[model samples]
Target chain A: MRYLRLYLHFLRFSFSRAMEFRLDFFFKIIMDCMFYVVNLGFYKILFLTTPMLAGWSEDQTMVFVSSYLLVDALHMTVFASNMWMIPFSINRGDLDSYLTRPVSTLFFVSLRDFAANSFINLLMAIGIFAYTLMNLKAPYTTGQLLFYVGCILNGWLLHYVLQMIFIIPVFWTQSSRGFSDFFFSMGVAIERPDLVYRGVLRWLLTLVLPFALIVSFPARLFFGPETPHLFLHLVFVTLAAWGFMLWFWKKGLRAYSSASS
Target chain B: MSWPARVVSTELRKILAYRSDFWVNFLGQTIIQLFIARALWQSIFESNGQTEIGGFTLSQMTLYYLLAPLTIKILMGENIGFFSREIYDGGLNRYLVWPLPPIGYKLLTYLTYSAFYTAQLALLYTFARFFLDDRPYELSEFLRLIAGLGYILVAAIGYFCMMCLCELVAFWADNTWSLGVMLRFVAGFLGGTFLPLSFYPETLREIIQYLPFAAFISGPVNLILGRSTPMEALQSFVVMLVWLPILGLAVRALWKKGNLQYTGVGM
Candidate 1:
């Protein structure tokens, strides 16, 4: 309850701040919309020459794209700005401020900036998602829809975990951005349907590094024939990932030789 | 070394100083992106059941994706916000005090990043040759590769001018980072960095053929891949050349206007 109240404050302040830079707010929306267009266009153009991409018809592929976009939108709205600041704060030794706060440092740092600008984009993403679902040939039940939304939320959490895992390494490497570029390079998988991957690569993306699971697992649950086992596997991996990130984050704090010192 | 040359060289060395950055920026990104592209194109060809899509074999398409990002890095360079930062934070005051053309110094640093990435491309191409099944290049295609690189280098200046004009917007706008990002996304999409021009709708492809973005990326990659003869490459180069002066003049005009507006108050 307390955390939720704090988040409300964060959202309120973020929205107020966003109004100050109205032009930037709008430009960011346009920028993200273009990104959506390109992602959809990529699959669209490929489907032009082919009947199926990894067994998903063009409409199904569009749904997958929309799913990823929603994940992206939610991640951007809730986490991206906050997660992006971790390495910088670590580098500047500004972690001291957060650590001294009365609230849980991790919760405070992670949810402090709500990215109200991107919340608009999130709504836009939902519109795009609705548009795609209208074309979805296969009808889904209310249970399935609710389950899909739950999986997407999990996907967003996984993205946050991955980002923390990538940025926390700044404690030792002390590089400005840590492993973000590599993480982003790997994130290309999220834009692509995991069905396109095969064999070792598939397992690697699903279980090991789990970049593909960001949208792929949730997407699979929504689109593929009942893969309860696979969904359970996603749950397990996501839990394990969270455990690792929390442990790694603690270790990073221990290693965090303050920059000024 | 001359003053500006030493400045650029020293700045380049500083950027390469962070060992982690050096690895991620040069080595890891290229390798990972290539892996994804390889997987994607493989699935594409298998699903399509076509040996050729838009006149490209899987191997040729792989080569195109590889060259696309590299060519774009050379053309777009790094977005260090040299001018944009100065404009926003009143750092331009220092540049005005210094006996230098801030634009010239900024270009030197910008192209240094491009040059560094170009070296990365060359190094990766050499490494790739060992892993690739066939000889990656023919002796006959050698001159065309050289010609393509030559045109890319010249085109880099034109791209620099365009970006300069963009960063100049900071003088007027409250922030321009969004503009910078918008430009990159637009450039990537239009320049065929995201996908081949062949994948584009015919009308869109024809329109983009005359655009500088295609000439900057598609024109160079195709020429290096031996898809285009010297004459054809020259035709593309001519298209880019026409934009060069227009962009350069725009940069000059914008900078003059921006300087007039610049209060250097750190506002």
Candidate 2:
């Protein structure tokens, strides 16, 4: 209840702040819509050339794209600004304020600024996801969809954890960007369907690095059998990833020598 | 060194100092994009048993993907923030006081980066000549490759003008970064970076062919691949030439208005 109250405060403050830059608010909507349009158009044109991509039909691909868009919109709304500011917070010693607060530093840092600008975009993404899932040929129970939604939320959490893993290096490297560039390069896997990747790349994206687990795993399982294998795998990976994130965050904080404040 | 030479030298040094960021952002992005494209296209071709789609064989498509990255690198360049950072931080005041033309200096900095990318384009074309094992580019194609570079230089300058117009909005708006983002998104689609304009409907393709975006990505790639001739590349250049003068005037007018509005206290 305390954390929820703190989050509500954050949402209130962020909305008030967003109202200051009215042009930026509108521009954010346009920018995100352009991105969504391009993503949908790219697949639309590709599907015209070939009926199937990675054994998934146009509608199935739409589901995958919409799911990724939802995940992205959720991230943008909640975590993206926080993660983007981490390097600066570390570099400028501003994180000391976060550390001194009574709240959990991780919670405060990750959730302080609710992106009210992206809330509308998030709604648009959810609409796309819903529209794509409608008139579906694939047979799945509401229980299955609830399960898939649970996995997708886990996928979003895993995305956060993975990004934090890349960003925690700012405590030492102080390289301005840390290792975030490499993280983004690998993030391409999150946009693409998992089956197109073959052999070692498949193993790498799915198992060791596990970027595909962010969206593809959830989408694939939605269409596939209601097997516990993938669900258990996702739950295990996400829990382990969160555990690693907490451990790494502690280690990074220990290593941090605060810069000029 | 002369003023222009000194500016170029400093930009080159900056590139060397942050070469890691350059590799990760530019080359890393290009490699991953090509990897995904290759995997996706290969699957489509294999499943459908179609060796060619939209006049591009698998090999030609690979070459397109390769060349397209170079075109993008030249256009986007190494500076992610570029001029907007200077304006936002009020560092533009320093350049304004300099006895040289500010726009000229900035343009020179932009082309220096493009020149480096242009050299990379040549090297890649040469590498493709020998190692595109299934169908190597012949010597005649190499001549066309030189002609194609001329068109690409035009595209780089053309895009620089467009971006300047975007960034110049910073004078009035607190954050003009979104304009740049919007420009890049539009360029990615309409410029044929994500999907070739050839794949669009006939009317759309024909209209976009006259637009600088298609000439930016597809025109140069097609010319080097022998899918287009120097004549066609020249025609694209002519189209770009029409947009150039108009963009130049807008940029000039904005800089003048911006200078008048400048309080020089970083807003």
Candidate 3:
């Protein structure tokens, strides 16, 4: 409850900051709107050439695309700006301030800065997701809809975990952009259906990086055949990712040397 | 050496000084893009049960992806935000007193960096040859490749000028980072960095073909792929040439007006 209140404070501060930069606030929305358009258009164009891609129909693929966009927007809103600061903080030893905070330092550092600009974009993404859901040819039950939302949240969490894993390497490498670039490159996997990948690459995205699960799995759960096993897979992967994050965070902190020290 | 030549060499030396940074930053990104493009295109082709889509076989499409990064490196201008930072922080005052033209200095530096990036991409291509299937090049294709390189050079200059105009928004706005990002996204989509313009609807593709963005990337790629005839390639070159001077003029005009607004108080 205390953490919730603290997060509320962060949210308030974020909005105040956003209001001070009204032009930037609008520009970010326009930029993301363009991004969303381009993303949808890419899939639309692909469908024009072929009726189905990777066994998924055009409308079904729209749901997957919308899922990733919402996940991306959520990530940008809640985590991106905060994560971007980590390398700079570590380099400058400003992370000491975070470490000294009373709350869980990892949670505090990672979630403190809500990107209020991106929050508006997040709403736009949600609108798109709703549109896609409405237009989906296959009828879904209320229970399935709720389950899909839960899975999308899981996908967002998985994205955060994967990002943190990439970021922890900065503690040693001291190269801020290197791992971040690599992470973004890997991020492209989530944009397409996981079924497109084959062999070791498929396994890598599924188990190791888990980009496949980030967006595709949630859409799969909703549209594809009922697979009770998938629920177990999602749970196992989320737990495994969470466990790995805790271990890596602890290890990174131990190696951290404060500037004053 | 001439002043411009000297500037280029100095910038080239600076890039060489931090060559490892390039490998870490660029090479990883290029490889990742290649991986995604190859996987996505292969899957699409497999699902369609067709050997060709938009005149590109799977191997040809893979080759296009491999070459697109190189073309982008040579043609797509960097968003250095140098002039913007200078204007915002009063660093422009230092350049104003310098002997050389600031724009010339910037252009030379950008060209030098592009040259280094192209050389690095060439090295990667040599390495990639072992992994990728070889595609035979006809004499006409080689000639078109040379022509494509010329077009890429002009497109790079035009893109640099356009970026300069975008960055000049800092003169009025507090920050131009958002504008820079918008410019990049627009360019990436319209320039065919994400996918071939041919993949777009025919009407849209036809319109984009004449847009400066196509001149930047897709036009060059089409030339190298032998997708466009000699006349068509020449027409794209003409389009690039037309846009470059207009963009150059806009940059010069913006810089002149922006200079009047410069307070140089930050220094």
Per-residue alpha-carbon lDDT of candidate 1 for residues A1-261, written as tens digits (9 for 90 to 100): 988898899999999998898877887888788888888888887777788877788888898899899999998898888888888888998989888888888898888898887898899999999999889999999898888889988988998898888888888887878888778767788888787778887887888889888887787789869658989888999999999999998998888777731
* Least well predicted 10-residue stretch by lDDT in candidate 3 chain B: B16-25
Task: State the displacement of the C-alpha of residue A136, model 1, in Å, after optimal TM-score superposition.
Answer: 0.7
In order of TM-score, best first, we have 1, 2, 3
DockQ list for all candidates = 0.67, 0.58, 0.54
Interface RMSD for each of the candidates: 1.6, 1.9, 1.9
Report the candidate with higher DockQ, 1 versus 2: 1
Top DockQ hit: 1
lDDT of 3 by residue, B123-150 (tens): 6654564456465545775576666666
Worst 10 residues of 2 chain A by lDDT: A169-178
- Chain A vs. true chain A, TM-score per model, equals 0.96, 0.96, 0.97
Error of 2 at A141 (Å): 2.2
lDDT of 2 by residue, A159-184 (tens): 99999988887787656777787788
Q: How do the residues B1-267 of candidate 1 rate in per-residue lDDT, one tens digit apiece?
A: 787888777878877778876686555567667777878888879877888878888877877778888888788776637678888888889975787788888778878877777777766665664465375557766676667777778878888887887688888777677777777777788888888887888989889888888888888888887777778778888899998988988999998888889898874
- List lDDT for all candidates, in order: 0.82, 0.82, 0.81
**True-contact fraction for model 1?**
0.61
- Tell me the tens digit of each residue's lDDT in model 3 across A1-261: 999999999999999998887876877788788889889988887787888887889989998999999999999999998998887788778899989889998998899899998988999999999999999999889999999999999999999999898888767765544277678767888898888888888888888889899988888889869578987887898899999989998998998887621
Question: By DockQ, is 2 or 3 better?
Answer: 2
Best to worst by DockQ, what's the order?
1, 2, 3
